[model samples]
Target: MTTRTFTNRLTRALRERALSLVDTGRPEGLVFLGAAAGTEIAKATGFGPLEKVCKPVIAPSALVVALRDGELGAVDTALLSATGAAYTVGDVILMLGGGHASRSVARLASGAAAFGVGHVALGALMLRSGIRPKALQMSFHGAVAGTVGGMLLREDRGNWPLATYGGMLAALSALATSVDHGRAPSASVLAVGGPVFLLSDGLILARRKVAGGSLAARALDVGVIDTYATATLLLLTGTAAAARSARGR
Candidate 1:
């Protein structure tokens, strides 16, 4: 081919590649924004220290990159899991301030609200992923159930706003269970994470309800941290696998 023709082809190819990046990058950008908004809002409400504000942002952003490029493996998965664990640990550390007794209801309520915003972002991601209308409806149902559960829970009983937060988290977890991860070989793996996520949050809510000094209550307390850490690790690993599958296609 002539030099002019080759130059024209090269330019066209580059333009197309750039456009493709923009297309995929849109959802990834939303993911990052969601994470950042969650982290910053949670920080503003004193959910955790300011120094840890980037925890939420970093975890989701890294997952986005992994999804886009399909760069993930055992070590990468470990790091992602570690990041999630650290993020949860930050909240755990807050209890050391004075335990639940030291935390005000308003602060707790605000933290839950901040997390609701994050869940909204997660919903957007779900829609972008092509979740069916029926599945979406079921997610709302999960929210309702969770809201009722939250309202009934002893410690947070009658706290409509906090119940709403529980609803949001429940919705996301439910949605995760029903989402079509496409033909990604790890679709089953992705489904597993959702239930674990639900379990983690359930433990948190249960812990609040049962403030006894009993062994079961203590187990619930510790389980909150353990399950949360495990949930994050599993969810991110599944995400990575799905990403890899997509990239291969």
Candidate 2:
């Protein structure tokens, strides 16, 4: 398809997907147990988190392929640090600030850190495999990272967004390099976007779970939205980026 057509389709698809995720978040709100407590939760809340979590999401592999057509991201941006340190780089280190710092990365070094780091790692993988962040890749990468981060980290601890997202972006920069062809993506993005995405996902789903009256049953409610919404956001971002790229092309 022509770039314009692809852009139009992607735009429409994203709008639709956004609506879908929003809609999916609703049923829980209607019967929300917090309003009535436990009894209301069992009988009233129809959509359990599991039901929300199980829904399938479309993967935008093509956008990643387009990114490969350009150049390696590392040439212009570096994913790794100079002396094998993760936080030394300008961008990565900057994540220490309070703003988005909640999405901090933890490794053998960070210890007991959030898994959002994995999503960032995957971002590098996709880029290296020649996957462009155009629109789909970026959004999906970010969303997944955010979802995973929320799941793993819960100390209410905050870290640097730069190190986390910065690392992922560095990976995207490296992907532009193409050291290996089509390497399977790492789950790092799940680690990076965790804090941000979780906050958003929980805000949307948690209310419903509480209202549905079964806080325990819906404890994973935010996860339900994260499972699909995060992936969709990544695809949408990639699609939008692709659209912009096509314009330049």
Candidate 3:
């Protein structure tokens, strides 16, 4: 081959590699961006007292997921944005010290409620997009199972109200996913990510039931949180890419 032709082929190959890297790295980069943004917001709002740790830990990945969903136009951008905002606010509330147990429960409940609203909105969007009714029904069943498991496994019986609220929210999120999965551009990602998200939350609840210092609790905590973050990143980014591909077709 001519030297000039060889050089041209090499350049094209390099360009393709560069594009691939950028595409793969964008989601992770966005996660870091969201985390940094959430940390700054927490500090500025005096919500950093506890969330300086927790918010930075979770919000980034979650926000990245929401942003990816928005970018793909697979879900309602406004609703996804609102969900992130609400969760951030709720985290701040939960982290706030100097509150009675009841007060803390109330704050947590409020956060869960906000999350439920987001889930309901997501479900509505899915339905509007023509998701099948069977998907919705299956989601409802999964939600019911989640609620029952949460209620039964709650550590503090006195916090039943909070547990109930959380269970309800989980159900709503599942319901939303059911609808979303029906028309999702990437059903496989949704299938895996959705269950992992639920499992993560379930583990979080399970931690409350288990002894704080126990190895089981610690394992559950780490496993769930990490899985949740990773799953969100995968699900959102995968779905977004798939949606874009479908649109192109």
Candidate 4:
């Protein structure tokens, strides 16, 4: 590559790093992986069939369901009334594991997998019928993600939610693979990494703020904080996970 072109790409990569402060710890890798994943899906199943397989099944919240039933109104929204944002995204995720939403997601994933198998079987038939390449590309990706998602959802680990996020991230990474290049890490890494990075950064940011010293001093504080924080969080989360698993057995 020309020097100018190499410089431009390097510049973009640096910009991506800065942007990642608000994004995932793994962004380029995530987007490229999702997009590239979308591409493989395209190859296996056409876009239309794939969409049908992977559409978010409505696992609406109680408030949302109440709204649908006309029992609640926009003025009474809990999210709007809450004092903390903690209940926002975090709760929405946990809620999926709670009630009908869990069953609904599981059922939808299962249906998608079944339909995907049929699509793959018939993809063979359509090759002779001479379907367009673009359509085939989309179909393949849809089938892969849908099928893979359904299988992963059955994991007994507390990873159903993480798996959903992972599959979507992977599919998205696949979609944008042309821009970012790497062997995509599995969703499980990301599932844990999200909290790992957040807790690590939060502890550092907190110590830096509280240490009330110059940058170099604060940098030293960071080393101390990370050492303690990571050990503690890993111990707690790992212990909890182990207990849950033992209970299951």
For model 4, how does the per-residue alpha-carbon lDDT over 1-249 read when each residue is reduced to its tens digit?
A: 554654455455435433432345434334423433342343234343432222111111211211222221232233211211221232234223321123344543443343223223222222222222344434554565566456555654443653454344333223322121111111112123223433332333234234243554344333433432222222222222222232333
TM-score of each: 0.53, 0.28, 0.58, 0.21
List runs of model 2 lying over 4 Å from the truth.
1-6, 12-114, 131-249
Best of the two (2, 3) by TM-score: 3
- Kindly provide the TM-score of model 1 when superposed on the true structure, using C-alpha atoms: 0.53
lDDT against the true structure, per candidate, is 0.50, 0.33, 0.49, 0.31
Best by lDDT: 1
Off by over 4 Å in 4: 1-8, 12-161, 180-249
Q: What CA RMSD would you report for each candidate?
A: 14.6, 14.5, 10.2, 21.7
Ten-residue stretch with the least lDDT total in model 2: 80-89
The residue-by-residue lDDT of candidate 2 on 122-230, one tens digit each, is 4444444345544544465456556545543453334344234434543343333222212212222222233343343334323432434354434444343343334
Model 2, residue 195: C-alpha shift (Å): 13
lDDT of candidate 4 at residue 126, scale 0 to 100: 22
Better of 1 and 4 by TM-score: 1
| Best by the TM-score measure | 3
C-alpha RMSD (angstroms) for model 3? 10.2
**Residue by residue across 132-223, what tens digits does model 1's lDDT show?**
43566475657666656656565545566656666666666666566453535343343455566567666665665564555665566556
Model 1 Cα shift for residue 20 (angstroms): 31
